[model samples]
Each structure stands twice: as C-alpha cells, then as structure tokens.
Target: MSQRSEAGSDAKPGNRLTVVIAQLDFLVGDIPGNARDILEAARSAERVHGADVVVFPELCLTGYPPEDLLLRPSLDLRIQEALDQLMAAELDAAIVIGLPLREKGLLYNGAAVIDKGRITARYFKQFPPNYQVFDEKRYFAEGTEPCVVDIRGVPVGLTVCEDIWSDGPIESAVAAGAKLILNLNASPYDIGKQARRKALLERKAQANGISIVYANLVGGQDELIFDGGSLVVDQYGQVAMEAPQFSEGLYAVDFTHERHCQPVSQPLPEEPSLPHNIYSALVLGVRDYVNKNGFKSVVLGLSGGIDSALTLAIAVDALGADRVRAVMMPFRYTADMSREDASTQAKTMGVQYEVYSIEPMYDAFMQTLAEPFAGTEPDTTEENLQARIRGVILMALSNKFGAMVLTTGNKSEMAVGYSTLYGDMAGGFDALKDVPKTLVFELARYRNEISPVIPDRVISRPPSAELAPGQEDKDSLPDYAVLDQILNLYVERDYSAEAIIAEGYERADVERVTRLVDVNEYKRRQAPLGIRITERGFGKDRRYPITNGWKIGK
Candidate 1:
C-alpha cells in the first residue's frame, strides 16, 4: 500500500528555511500513479507545510528496488515523462525526487532538485548496494560527482539511500560546500535496523557538522517491508525530530546559515518495542503483498496455536474480517480445546470460519498406506498423514473460493524440518516463516493489547501439534527459547557449533540443532515466501547446499 495522506503542521523555526520530509510510501513500477503521488505531496509540502524545499525518498518516482523493471525498454521514456510532469507542475518549493537517469547508454540512480519549472541540480547515487536483496549494480553506473543544491541561499547536499550508508558521498558533499544534507532512503525493514540508522546518521551529522534531514519510504514491496522511521538530526548530533515507525507523513526541519539548523525541543519517538516493530512489519508486508497482487482475500488453517492465531489477527488487521477465512480440520488425536479456541478466536474477529473433521480423509489415507507400512513400525510418516489431511482441506476451501491460502509455520519449525512438507507447508504465503516460535507468542500478546481477540487459555497452554495422543512441541524438540537463540546464531550469524557452544550453549544441543538446519535445507527451499523481519531470512539472505555432507565436528 502507498501513502494514505501526509499533511502536518509546517514548522518555521526563525533562522532556517523549512524543509519538509515527504515520508510517504510509493508503489513499485506504478510510474503514472507514483508520479501523481509525488506531485500531490510536493504541492502539499509547499502549501500546507510551508516548506522551502520538500525532500522525498529514494526512487520516489520509480519506486525502490525496481529490480528487472529497470530492464524494461520503456523505463527511460517513463522516467522522462515523470520529470516533464514535475517540471510542468511548477511546484512552489524546491522539490527533491529520486528517479533513474538514463544518459549516453549509462543509467544512474539519481535525485533531481527542481525549482521554478526547471531542474536546478541533479545528484546521482554514489553507492549502489549489491549485497543481500540489493542488486543495484545490474542497472546503475557508479556516480562520483558531489551534488549540493542551493535551497533558499543555503547549500544542501543530496545523497541517495546507499550513498549515506558509505562515507564518500556525504564527505564529498561536505567538501562541495553543503551546509545541510538531505538523504533519501528506501531501506528495507529488519530487526534493529532503525537503531543502527539513527546511530549512524547522528555520527555523520556530528562528524560533518551539518544538519541532516532524512526522508524514508514506508510500506511493503513483495517480501520486504520499509518502515518509515525518518529522522532530522541537528549539527550537534542531537535528534531534532523523528517520524514514527509504520506511519507515513510530511515532517519538517527548519535550517539557516546563522544557526546551521534552527533548534527545537521536539520529543523523539519512543523506541519501538520488539512486538510493535515486528508486528507492524508483518502487517504491512501482508497488506501490500495481498492488495498489490490483486488478491480478493485470504484463507488459512486455524489450529488454535500461537502461530496461526497471530497470523489470523494480522490478516484481519491487514485486509479486514470480511476478506479472511479460517478453517479447522481435526483428526483422531485433535483435542476439543483446539477446536474451541479456534472457534472462539474466529468468532471474536468476526471472520468466516468452518470446521471440517478430517477423520474420514485420514482414514482413507491410512487405508491406502497400510500395505506400504505393513511390515514397518509406525513413524513420522503416519503422523504426517494427519497434517497432510488438514492441508488438503484448507487448500480445497481456498480453491472453492478465490482466497489465497496462508501457511502458518514459524521460523523455528521451518529451520529443523519440524513441519510436514506439502502438508502443513502447502500455501501461497507463510506469515510467520521469518518469525521464530518464541516471538510468535509475543505477537499474540501484542495483538491482544489492541483488543482481546486471542483467548487467554490459548496463550497459557503448552503448544502441541495434536497429531498424536499427548503430543507436545517440547517432546520432539528443544525448548523454544533455547532453540530460537541457537537458530539465530547459526542461521542468521553463520556461527559454527563450536562458537555457539563457547557462548554457553550445550555442545549436544548446538550440534543437534545446526545439524538439523543443514539437513533440512531442502524443506525450507520448498516453503512459501514470507515477511522478512530478521537480518537474515532463509530464502534470500541465507542459502545452503542441500547435498552437502559437512558436519559440525568430528
């Protein structure tokens, strides 16, 4: 979803000119619609915020990480059309907007400073991120020139997203006589990313002794979610103002030659709690993926577990109760409380829900498999039949309706192959695929803070698959708190078993968990894509060879 609206009071702190930060979300590849949003926000910044200059996020016109869309033949033409529209608008304030510039058979990620129906200055992004989910080098040439545009007689430096992450661009702009720097960003969300950005920007502000105004894009694009934690840091390394996370708006910072930047006592946004940040990221990710892809609604199995409960709440909050469907498929060992809790939560959220017992289906599958297992002891193969039965029921509902099926497995189960393949994992998307099991419970509590949707008993009860009599998660796996930490160290940080053990974890548990993760690569590869809230998610950030024979220790 793009920005809803961003009209806030314009600050006029006497000494400096007011520069508005257009903290808005832009839809990827929607050139025409994105152009309209840019124009509307530019005009509003000047008219409502009384901004002398309004700064938008990186690639505001074309959207960030446009990926292969940059390879399209008509991209250059669309960009030129957008620039022409901006020039034609004759915006009152000097508007800074990011776009891709194609010239002389070379394309550069650029930010244009427009004033008086003309392009006053242009700054190409000095650094193009090429790691992790970024592949900017594929479409853009490296920019070495420094850009400092004169806004109301003050020289303001311009830098794109990755440019500020590095040293050269900001330093180059400072050398080019910029008293203030306006950095535009489309940085994707990860746990602790906002803190890192804030600290880095503050240090840059103090080192350069230039007031920095940052504008960031907010919303979701496919698997990534960009949180709008835009900042305004004074020359003294003090935070003057900061926009709230998961919100879009036009925020302003006043600046002048006399004071460098006009000072204010604006209260800094409180640090977002872990639940708040991750939950917000997931909601935005689901909302955009669903709406942007033009899906009518979504459906999922409601197992009365913490993972599905959180997923259901997130889906309802994102698309509303009308667009979500909950299905409960119970087999022989399925508990009555599971059904009761699923019904209670579904009714509380006012979602369309149904219960279809999978007893007949399970029986049919068992009868077919009885011959194959005639001489073998019963194992996980039989237990997996139950989950596969439920998966079929949920998918059938999704097919009957047009709703997409949402798989409800968390990162912990995904890491060690604790989930059944094509059974519980059969779906269009996984809401908690990046989230650890420990965090899932936290999110359930977080959602309840807004309103009491999840039953208290659900939260307090010990988690179980209910696939067999007296089944519990801890019976087959280590405690979640212990497992999640080990998973994070190994999967996210690439820590070796020895290193994890040195950190006080038992050698046996570390070796066992890491072994499971390495062996289960094939399963995770088949799982549906989900929201990425951590630094390293399984799909994009972490890649492993499934056929490897590497072991933790001799």
Candidate 2:
C-alpha cells in the first residue's frame, strides 16, 4: 500500500475533517487530459482547502461508459499508465479517482485511492447496471468485496456509482467501522432525478450512521447529459454542501468526527430556476456535442413556427449567434406572417439570416417528375417536394460552411408522423427531439419570461409546417395537449395501446398514435442525435429494430 510522508498526525480530538468533492467534466477517451485535470483538482484541494482527501466522479479517467474502447488493449494500457503518472505526483492529501480495471481477463469498473505516490486500495464496482443506457454487464465482472481505507486516522469506505444504489456497500462499510463513505458516480440527467438522488443518499446516510459524500460527473456524452449535482450529507441526514447542477466546480465540506459527525451549516447556492436549469442543460448538451466532435458552426431551417424559433434560441445560446446561421425557405403555401416571424426572430437573436425561395427548385422537381406523375393530382406530393427542396438547400449550406444542420421537430410531431422524412428530419442534431410540443410552448413562454427574445406572434400563433395551403399541425395530428398525454403514456411511460385506451383515451386515438409511433421507427433511426431528458429517449435507451413484424393487437 502507498504511504505518504506523515503530515504530522491524525486530526486532534474535536478537529474537523476537510473533504472536497470535485465535480468535473471529463472528455471521453481523453486519458492524459483527464489525468491532468484530476491532479490539478487534487493540488487545489490540498493547498487551498487543506483537505485530507479529495474524491472525483466515477470513470473520471476514461470518462463514463468508455463503451467498447475499454476492450482495447492499448486503451487499457494507457489508463494504467495514466494512473501511474498520477501516483507519481507528490501531494499531502489522499486522492480517489475512478477508472476501469482488467484483472485475470475480467474487466471491472474500479476506483483507486492514491497517497504518497502509491495506490493504497482499489474498489471494483459491485453493480453493473444493464438496463436503459447502461450496458456494464456486457463488459464488466461484478466486484464481490468492499474497500475500506484510512485517511488521517478516519476509516473511509469507497464505492463506485452503482454500488451505493443498494444497501450492501453502505452496510459493508459501516460494518467494517468506516466513519465516512465516499461514493463516486457518473450518473446521467433525467427530469426529477436530482430529487430522487438526494432522497436516496439521505436515507443511506441516516441508515448507516456515517457521513456520505456523493460526487457525480457533468457534461454531455453523445445523447446522455450528466448534471453534476454532487453533494454531502451528515449522519443525521442533513445536507452539508450541495454543488450547482449542470456545471463543473469543486465543493468542500468540513466534518468533525466526535461520537458522530454532526451536520455543520454551510451556505449553499440556491437551486436554479426550472427554466434556467433546463435551458442550461440544453445549451451544455449542444455545446459539448458540437465542440467534442470538432464542429465549427451550426445551420438550421427557420420556419415561422415556434419549434424552429425555440431551436434557434437554443443553438445561439449553445454555439453563440456568430456561429449559428438560419435559412428562411418560403414555399408556395407559405404565409407572409411566417416569413415575418422567421426574419424577426433571426434579427432579434443576431444570427446570420438568409432567404432562399424553394419555388425554383420545386418547379424543377415537378418538371422532372411530370412524366411519372401523368394525370395524378399534385396534393401532399407537391408540399413534400417543397420540404425536400428546403432540406437539400440546408444540407448544402452545412456541407459548404462546415456547419451541422440542426433539426427542429418536437416529440409530438415525431410521434404522429407529422414531420417530413428527408425534409425537416435531415440534420446533424435535433434540439427538441425529446421535448414534446406542449413543453415546447412552455419553454417559449419561459424564454420570454427571461427576456423578449422570441416574438409574441411566434409563441401565440398556431403551429404549422405550411406544407399545404392553410396547413396547421392539427390538420393531421390531434391537438398537442391530447397528443402529448397519449405520447407520454405510450412512449415515455411504455404503456400499451390497450392500457392507454383504458386511461380514458379513445380506442381509435390510441391505436392511431401507437401505430404511427411504431411505423416511424425508421425515421427516428435516421434522425440526428439529441439530448435525453426523459427516462427513455430515442437514441441508445430505446432500441427497437427497424424492420420488425410485431403488431400490438395481433
């Protein structure tokens, strides 16, 4: 075990134990960079706060779910090398960091405690969550034992993300005489998850009679966004320190070990307003997805509708107005109000705006398809042609300017197949892909509450794609309130058609919406990646085969 040059001795009687939880954002696969970040945080904690030990989020080295990269021999070697380099640093405080470990041909999600240039103890993750976005069981072998170590004469227990979700880890640590429990995590964000986490941690602390420190990772990884709400609770289930959500920072707490550590009062930052919290989450999601993948700018089609308006607001907030560009594509059926709303919003947001009429392109397509369309009436076909033309133009801009196109369709439209396939769906990212239409209106109202960025007409007017003359969203799909309710049950809550009908929904409506959702799996498969705020999002969490024969009533 690693031993540090004694900084003298343990805490004196009635002395306080200083602990810091480093809520950091780590880029996946960036081992050297992450290691440097870990070291920097450790140094800061030791020098600035005089902390006895510092803890970081789970999988801080390789980032969370290094996915298949954990299987690569070279990556594993690099992780070990990074840990060695971290151990080589001379620091007074013991540091606990998370990484993956491969032992005897079995991989485990592990955390290591380092002090005086040596690893004192290593704890492998006991639970590998396999449901939803987690697939740890596919790659990791569950650890059977808990790790307990000494820091300045205080017995400390170590557990990875999933270990603390149950009673075993905490029970084992308390049974082993641990006075404090440090839980490392890479927990992803879902609406209302923060409250759930706090309740669980409080219960664990109260039950075990030990002060518990919880640290979680922050930032967007692919479709998953982690809101770092790292926190600390004392033996009596009182919160001592709480970090802000959706940002990276270090939070410190002082624990005095007597017969038990009584909770100390510390002024914590106020919880962010709901709109601010959700908006920040969306912005972070977009920024990380673009910057991490090396994109310079973003492009999106701006209809005179609320969906596109809100999407533009999010893009400008994420990538800055200078980095965002909007295109106005007016079709034959487009209204003058839409044109005005689109232009006004663009100018208001200070983004580069351009006008591109798809009439010329529509004429060209009609001429090309005239022979095959012999005697057929141009109905939805002509409307769809306009959408495709706009899509092609936006994609061209994306290619020429090196900007990714952002799609603006919401969950309600997506569920009812009200959106065009290659038209509105063609983009590198979808900002509102998981957000429903009702929530879209709520967000627009919330944005306006902050400042009058979106035009009043944009929020007040009925939503329409203007694909056909006098087209409104309700022309094909049901009203958003009803649609969203049906979808929340059918899609988000995973209710069957019969179950939805039993909940007072008309049988026909339930069947129509559910069938549309099932049929549109192909479209969702082709859609761009988006942030996941709900329990089950379209990306990795809800996996349905594209070509499947399963029917609801059959």
Candidate 3:
C-alpha cells in the first residue's frame, strides 16, 4: 500500500503518530462498495504500516457530488449503515471519512472520526461552494463549528473540503489547541489546479502555525477529473510529503511531536508537464466513462483532420487498440490525402480500421429530397447531406455492433456553432469539447512525441470539414488564435462585446463571434457532453438561457 517502513507495535504512541492518506477512487452512489474499500484500506493502514489514523477523501462513503441523490429520503439511512459497517470492523487505527450527515432533519456535508468502535469526533463543512460545477448549497446546510480529537497522544482537528479553503475553520481548530489538521477533499482537476492547491495549502498552514494533511479522491466522475495530488505540509508552509497525481494508492506519513509538529521526510514526485497533465486527464476520463458505463468498445469517424485524429488517438490510448475502431467515410469532396492519412494512422495504432463510402447514402438522400426541394438551389443543405450520411452510417455501425460512437468537435467550433447538429455532433461522448483549436495542435505533437502514431502530414495540413470541395474552416470562422482569445474573455470571463473589442480586437470580429456564441446556444444544448479542461466549459460550469434576448454590450 504505502512506501513507508512499518512502525511496529513497539513504537511509542506518545511521541510518534503515523497518519496514512488513502488517495483512492470511489464510484458515486455506491455506498456499500465504497465502505468496503474504505474498511479494507483502513485495516491495511493499521496492519501493514502501523498507522495511528488513516484519512480518506471527502464523501468517500457515498462519493462526492452525489447531486440529486442527496435529496433521496433513504440517503440518511444508507449513510448510517455505511458508518455502522466501518465501526463494526473494530480497527485499531482511527478512520477519518466523509459523508452526508443528517441531524435534526437537516443534511450537512460532514466528516466523522471513528475510533475504538465509536465516533470520537464529528466535523461539518463550514463553507459550501456554490460556483462552477458545485451545487452543495442546494443540498447541504452550512456547519458553524470546529471539531478536534485526540489520536495517539496528538490533538488532531478535522475539516471537510470547502472548510480548508477558508481561514475561519482552521483558526477555530487552532484556538482549540489542535496541533495537526486533516482535510478531506473531492477536488476536481483543471489546468493549473494542482499549483493553486499547493499554494493554498502552504499559505494556510503557515498562517495557522499548524501542520495540514490533504487527502483527495482520484478518478473520473462524468465530466470531472480528480487528480489526487494529496500531500502533507509542515507548520512552516513547506511541503513535507507529496503523493503522485492521477494515481490511486495509499501513502503514509509520520509525525513526531515535541514542542511543535512536523512530518517525516518522504520523496516528492516530479512535476508533470502541462501536456502530460491534460493528456492523462483525458485518458482517465475516457477509460472510466467507457468501463463504468459498460461499453464493450468505442467507434468514431476518422477524418484526417486534427480534431478527429486527436479523438482517435485518445480513444486508442484510453482503451486498447482492440477496443477502438476507426471508420473512414469518404465522399466526392474527401481528398486523397485525408483517406491516406486516416489509413496510415489507424495502421500505425494497430486498431480495427474500415472504409465506408458515403457516396451512395448521399445519393439516396438527395433522390428522396428532390421533390421537396423543387425551388431550392444547391447550398449548405447539400453540404450537410454528406455529413448526415456519415453520421447515419456511424450510428448504424454502433447500433449493430454495440460500440459507443465518439464525436470529434473542439471548443472553437462549438463556441461559434461551426458544427452541424445530428451530423458530426451525433455521438455519445466528446473527449475534446473544452479544448481549443490551438491546444489540439499542441496535444497532437505531444502524443507523437510519446509515440509516432499520428502522421506528420495530418498535423501540418489545413483543418477542414471536407463536406464540400476545398471546405477549409477559415471560410466561415475567424482565425482560431483570435477566436479562442475572445471566447476566453466572453464565455469564460463573461466579457461584453464592447469590453472585448476594447481589449485590442476589431469591433466587427467581436460582434460576429459573440453573436454566434449567443445564437448557437440551442445547438450546444443538444450536443453530447464531454471532458471539461478549462475554467469554464460548456457543461455545468456555464449556464445561459437558450431563448433569452440579452444584448452583447458593455
């Protein structure tokens, strides 16, 4: 489990305290299964490492962000049963775990310290975050107190996820004579989130003059990815021990108390590159989504474009090449290089590859719509027919063989409604929904650095939908370098058109891009959900009225 030497039974409890961090993943709403894992981890922490206390992530019993499941009437009963099961094990070490606690008819996000077949202390979360993918205020009432307990002659304080982010709870615990504080969390991963957490912990521990232990959950929960970079910080705000990110395991730390307290030395993990962090998050997201949802395999339309090529690479990396299938749906508009690149990449990745020409399907659809389109001239309707044909063919394959269809649309296209609904957007999941066009190029290069699966030409070619002859994306959209900057200002930061234009952008470009983002709300509403990497993705992080008439001005 942990990499620490065993502190045998002869170790004195008065001078030494062994606290193990259980940085593991748990399924949401699987209370029984989660409890079993918690119990097993607790026992191993005590028996193998001789731990005095073992800390688990927030909501480890019922999982984090249970959403509407917390409103169920049986939620209280299930939580109680899980806690009772943990206590019945009668472990020698104190187990600090999190759950939704109900008291006097009000539910609170709380944690309990169970030791010697009883709950020694209970702590409720003081601050419940309500912004950006967190809706705890709707489900949990705020707790206004601090809880401190004694374990192995050390006065340890307890705090939930949001409580540690603020100063009041830790101050109260310190005032109550606590030497060490343990925080349980289910914090999700975003770009630069780990750095922010380390900074926050260092500042808080130094400010309070107390050592802190942070235990975080690891795995994918729908659109959220928990990276599990749990760690221990000394009273002087120095990182004492650090756990690996995007991994699941038990890590141990020892604390010796004299006049003050500090964690024993442990090797710190090397920081991963930015591309590595993002790629790992995507891989974990796809792997858990596929396995947990019971999908046998995944299939996608493999155009030689950068977006689809990246999606194919992620699918193959997430699930093995055998569990991934790539289909090249060619039409009259499809280029020879597109076909060649798709075939070359699929062959390099060693996945199941097939060719399905949409020419017959397009012809059949046109023949059926001839009478209804009597007065219509050829336009995007004709172009969209090719895309719809490819969508239908991919769906048919998914229906016949039971492989989940993965869509390939990046955020730059999604923000401007450059994508066609029920066409390229017709799939179950999208791994790059929050990624921008520029980031897609960077990730492709990063993957190739690991192994040269994607052909060099694919990365160097101009991006195009190829629904019509020479249909490059630049025809309808602004330069991605400009569009992504405006999007970050408008969609993520909520900047007005006038304000964005004032930021050195042209007025016409600002107006047009923001208008597309507004008018396309209905389309994005119908698109499949995907992984969230930015501060604000088009998922729960950003919610706008699809039918509103709000003007885009400062």
Tell me the lDDT of candidate 1: 0.86
- Residue-level lDDT of model 2, residues 109-184, one tens digit each, is 9988888788888888888899889999988999877777877777788888888887697888777777888999
lDDT, model 3, position 392:
90
Error of 3 at 303 (Å): 0.6
Q: What 10-residue stretch in candidate 2 is worst by lDDT?
A: 1-10
Q: Which ten residues in a row have the lowest lDDT in candidate 1?
A: 1-10
TM-score per candidate, in order? 0.94, 0.96, 0.96
Worst 10 residues of 3 by lDDT: 1-10
**lDDT to native, each model:** 0.86, 0.85, 0.89
lDDT of 1 by residue, 235-332 (tens): 88888889988878988766665746544547886777889889999998898888988889999999888788899999999999999999988777
TM-score-superior candidate, 1 or 3: 3
Pairs clashing within candidate 1: 16-255, 16-256
Error of 1 at 232 (Å): 0.5
Task: Please state the error at residue 20 of candidate 2 in Å.
Answer: 1.2
Best by lDDT: 3
